[model samples]
Target: MVELLNAPNIDQYAWGAINGCEAASLLEGLHCLGKLTNVNYGEFLKQMPIDEGGNPNYGFGGSPYKNQAGKFEAIFVKPLADWAANYTTYEDLSDSGVEPIYQSVEAGNPVVTYVTVHFEKPEIETYPFGDVAINNHAVLVDGVNATQVHLSDPIDGKYYLDKSKFEKIYLSRNMALALLK
Candidate 1:
């Protein structure tokens, strides 16, 4: 199934008002799987851990919070998990992370994941968290075919990617993801 989340619109906390793409995908993924309902980016922003660094702490648009990649759990995933239905957050980072993602989708959980905004962007932007390209985006992985996972990108909308091509982007940023099951 294809899924999508509305990008944030707040300029200060996001690339725009829709800066919480990762959070957005998390909400949509869980909802699509019936693990959560009615949550959105505004809810994520409201629940995300707050700090003096504000937007950067949340790494809105892939920019680091005061140059730090905010804790994916505290700043993003866990809070959502607390609101979901019969699901717990389990991490499956690397170690063939792609397979676990597909497994989770098959087992009735979609992955809320991190990826570059675009597959072709160069890692040129500097941040205290680390150097990054423009679109450190968040998405939902709910369906898979033989070689690719179907995902919903908040900024780019819904699409599929070559499994190998998807891994290059996911692994680049530590294979960031949250699984709700």
Candidate 2:
């Protein structure tokens, strides 16, 4: 078992928003990487591109505070990676599977991964560009053990998800982002 100690536990709602889990998780990863010390979520949110037109690949879609039915409500690995690049090196670990994810935790790197809210069963919504998980949410993976993955969830804070269950939701899109120092 390996864990990245002192991983930031940020609540998505603490910053006056119900969304922005992606940015929250990214901030946790950045803190884990020692890339950020004094954190201001409002400033960070301002730096992120808000793509109200539903382009997950380019930037965040929809309102970070509320979910719109037709717009893509989350940001994917690409934009997160692009944003993190300004602070430190990053790995676009999309479709890379679970082993590398665990390895990252072992190496003391926190990974921002896309999983369903509360780790529930995924509900995919089809977009004109492609199918997207309607319940899509992001969390920072800060630890891994023999049978569990430790996460700093932006919505629920720190918790453990069974490896099998985490894998199930994770494999739905197989998307992960990590910051490297």
Candidate 3:
């Protein structure tokens, strides 16, 4: 038996347009962990790791302007995990298979993963990594009951999606994931 849950109160638009969905989803996961363990996540998110770019930085952190590219999580996720270690440890689940993802979610932390900006709609472009479609949004995998995956979309809110659909978008974006333990 495996059961995991996260807070559904992630406000992806908390910082107006400065913070991206990825940052917001990370915030949601951290806040949920804080609630589960009684810690101060509010103070932490205000100073979380961020990409250094144009006005998008907006002091805290912001997404890159259109037409430009940057590895969003590479700029923060690992570092956030390192910083959060003061409270509890975390695991890097990037490029992992579905079973590991299931294990990660079963462990309590919702998997902070990516999906396409439009879910099924993506504009193919050649990035520094390779010629592939881009994942322009961030979401949390709250739980997995068999093949059904429950997720919280920072933009669309909470819902359960088909595993195949989730995998399609996730794998296409390189299966980027991080877990807090």
Candidate 4:
């Protein structure tokens, strides 16, 4: 199964007119998963997931919002044939640290998967910026795996994300359904 996660360098995602909610909507519309920061989460623990040790893992759950609830919800997954049909096998990716956006890593072709929209806050620090919080950006999860996935921001920058962080941010089936249409 493929999962999508938000990159650490979310600050550099500034592009186009779409907002965080809009970007998420676009990804969900495509039936693809997205990894992004929940801007409403706030600072200190702003969009950062806490580890067992209580240290911020810098990760959080992700999902599609503003769309019809049952449209993407599938009944069952056929293992090898229909990975997309099963919601449990698939996961939404994200991280509290800066990471890159991607879809999949199948050979050389990078296919676009989901769309992400993030809001930028100046209080947090992030890549391409120092001392300034660079949060709130959107990325499309085009492809992925246990290693990395292909990602593209609206500004046309492409990159990859490690799998460990990808596992950190995922929405539960119930959580996903709550955000769906």
Candidate 5:
């Protein structure tokens, strides 16, 4: 994350100017370019939102949405099912067990992985509300311990999730992205 926020010559390593598009549009175009195939993590942070003045939304790191970082996660993973047929082979996720699923390692392509993102409405939140209306956002799981999922809301920038507090959440979507490894 630090590297993407500070990297010089980032445009040379990847296309899509940071300020060029909203998260959804940027993800869609990159998926079309074939530059973002199954690869994960390596180039993702580059597409993160920058303020109109070309500054990182520093508040983001401290926001309640931090762990619940869905916009980016969903934007990254939404297009993979379309990109799958382009893969010469398919890998199964059932074997990944409790770990996040890992897939793809093709030359000139990004190694991508898929993970499910679960969310819940905010009516049940106990935290004090501020700039972000918790009711408007989804829950982001912050920890994974066997059958348990931990979540954080970036708006608070503090992780306050517990195993049982989030049953109100639902699976909003499945995410896919290229992995650095």
Candidate 6:
């Protein structure tokens, strides 16, 4: 088993309602890599880009303060990666599967990965642009073992998820961002 100690556990609710998971996960990853310290959540939230039209590929879709349906209410790896580049090096590992994730963890890097709320079954909603997981949530993968994956979740803090179950939800989108030192 390998676990990176001192990974930050940030609650999205502390920053916003149901929309700050991405930002919170990013914060956790950056902090885990020692790239950021003494951050102001308000200032960090203000700097993140928001695409009100529900295009998560470019920026966060919908308001970070609202939880209404059909607003997409999520952000993907691209925008997060671009924004994180300002602080530290990052790699967009979308569709790269679980191997790289373990590798990143093994290298003492935390990965910000997309998964459903509480790591539950994904609820996908298809839009004209693309499919969006309504329960989409982001968490920092900070540890790995033969049977379990540990996470610093934005909403639930830190916990261990079954490796098989984690991989199932993880591969659904296979979206991940590796924060490198």
Which is the leading candidate under lDDT?
A: 6
Off by over 4 Å in 4: 1-21, 24-134, 169-181
- Candidate 5 stretches with Cα past 4 Å from truth are 1-76, 79-142, 146-148, 164-168, 172-181
- What TM-score does model 5 achieve against the real structure? 0.26
Alpha carbon lDDT of each predicted model: 0.54, 0.84, 0.59, 0.29, 0.28, 0.84
Q: Name the better of 1 and 4 by lDDT.
A: 1
Task: Give me the displacement of residue 13 in model 4, in angstroms.
Answer: 8.2
Per-candidate TM-scores read 0.66, 0.94, 0.71, 0.28, 0.26, 0.94
Off by over 4 Å in 3: 1-4, 35-45, 53-87, 127-135
Candidate 1 ranges beyond 4 A from true positions: 1-16, 54-87, 92-96
Candidate 4 residue 175 Cα shift, in angstroms, is: 7.7
Off by over 4 Å in 2: none
- C-alpha lDDT of residue 64 in model 4: 21
| Preferred candidate (TM-score higher): 1 or 2 | 2
Quote the positional error of residue 54 for candidate 5 in Å.
21
Estimate the overall C-alpha local distance difference test score of candidate 2.
Answer: 0.84
Q: Deviation in angstroms for 96 in model 3? A: 1.6
Q: Per-residue lDDT of 17-38 in model 6, one digit per residue for the tens?
A: 6687888889888877776677
lDDT tens per residue, model 5, 21-95? 122222332343443545432344443432222112221222112322332212222233233334323232223
Candidate 1 lDDT score relative to the true structure: 0.54
Which runs in model 6 stand beyond 4 Å of their true positions? 68-70
Candidate 3 lDDT, 66-89, residue by residue in tens? 234454322334554554455455
lDDT of 4 by residue, 59-150 (tens): 12122211232121111111111222222233322331213222222322222222212222223433221222223233444457667644
Sort the predicted structures by TM-score, highest score first: 2, 6, 3, 1, 4, 5
Q: By summed lDDT, which 10 consecutive residues of candidate 5 come out lowest? A: 1-10
